[model samples]
Target: MSFELRRATVEDLSFARELTSQNMLRYYIEFELPWQDHAFDVAWSERQNWLIVRDSVPVGYVSLSRDMRALYIRELQVAEAFHRQGAGSWAIDQVIDIARGERRPAIRLTVFENNPARSLYERKGLQVQGRDECFLRMQLDISTPVL
Candidate 1:
């Protein structure tokens, strides 16, 4: 699906919340207790945020926080139906591009332990930086993904 991403507005919150949580569940391949609010709160407290769209309809979401030299990506999620459709990659590309434009040091994000995207991140050169009960923080070198 063709789509575009703009800076998220307050109106995007409702949509972002759902997409973010649902994506977490899907990424982990679990839900029962994994989708709990506790999971989101951890990311939210970091001050990162996002909302993505496809063909004029919201299709994905994320949350990000920037510190001294790092772009902390809290969450990134595309609707289950949108998997392999480029929605998630599109959103991630935008974030990296924007960060590069700003000369950010590195990009960071926390993904569920079982998330398949970890492989994508590995190919993209994002290395494990830390971990929590629900997330494995990955860091990408801003100088170049190949570094």
Candidate 2:
């Protein structure tokens, strides 16, 4: 499937908020994350949000941030209809490409400890870095070429 990433703007905030709300129940249950309206606002405003477009339609969105140390993935929500079609992987590959271009040492993200996506991330070479009560911190060192 052909897809592209577009930077999300203020116009896309409402759609993003709704989509995230609809799909975040699993994480909420697993991690006790609050589904507060302000939380979405914070993410929409602070992170580099990207709308995953396929054939001119928005299929999903991912929120990413980069600090001096690593590329931090804050959110990745693929519409249910588009799941299992590689949208998530494509989005992640985009982030990896950015990290490589910047020569960043690693990519980091927090996944709900029991979230199924953790296994997919592990398969993609991210290792468990640490964990707290609700989240598992995972890291992928990108300084070395991925084999």
Candidate 3:
């Protein structure tokens, strides 16, 4: 399957937000966290977002941002029908490439402690750097040369 990423615009907000809510709502409820629509709306407007397209159809979206030190993955969500087909991994690889291209030292993200996606992030080379009550902070130190 050939995957392409297209920049997300205002027109894509509903799809992206719904996809994220579908994928994350369980975790939010399980962790006793509030699902804030306004916050997601603000992020959609602020972040660098992309839709993961396969055969011209969108299968998911990824939201990203960066600082001087690292690239941050704010959201990564694949439609349930498309899970296990490698879209998520492909997105992560793309994010890594973007970080490397920009000369960022690392990639960072936070995942709910029990979220299954944590294993996928681990497989892509992000290690848990710390944890609080509800989230695990993970980072991939790309500054180190890959052997």
Give the number of the best model, judged by lDDT.
Answer: 3
**Model 2 Cα lDDT, one tens digit per residue, 52-143:** 99999999998988998999888888888998899988888998998898889999999888778888788878999998888899999997
After superposing candidate 2 on the true structure, give the runs of residues whose Cα lies further than 4 Å from its correct spot. 144-147
Order the candidates by TM-score, highest first: 3, 2, 1
TM-score of each: 0.77, 0.91, 0.96
Please state every model's RMSD to the true fold in angstroms: 4.0, 2.4, 1.9
Residue-wise C-alpha lDDT for candidate 1, range 1-147, written one tens digit per residue: 577866676566667667665655555455245456665555465565656777777778767788777887777778888888877777778888878877788998877778798887777778998988777889987874543
C-alpha lDDT of candidate 1 relative to the true structure: 0.73
Top model number, TM-score? 3
**For model 1, which pairs clash?**
48-63, 48-64, 49-63, 49-64, 50-62
Better of 1 and 2 by TM-score: 2
lDDT of 2 at 96: 90
Error of 2 at 6 (Å): 0.7
Q: What is the lDDT of candidate 3?
A: 0.94
Query: Candidate 3: lDDT of 123?
Result: 99
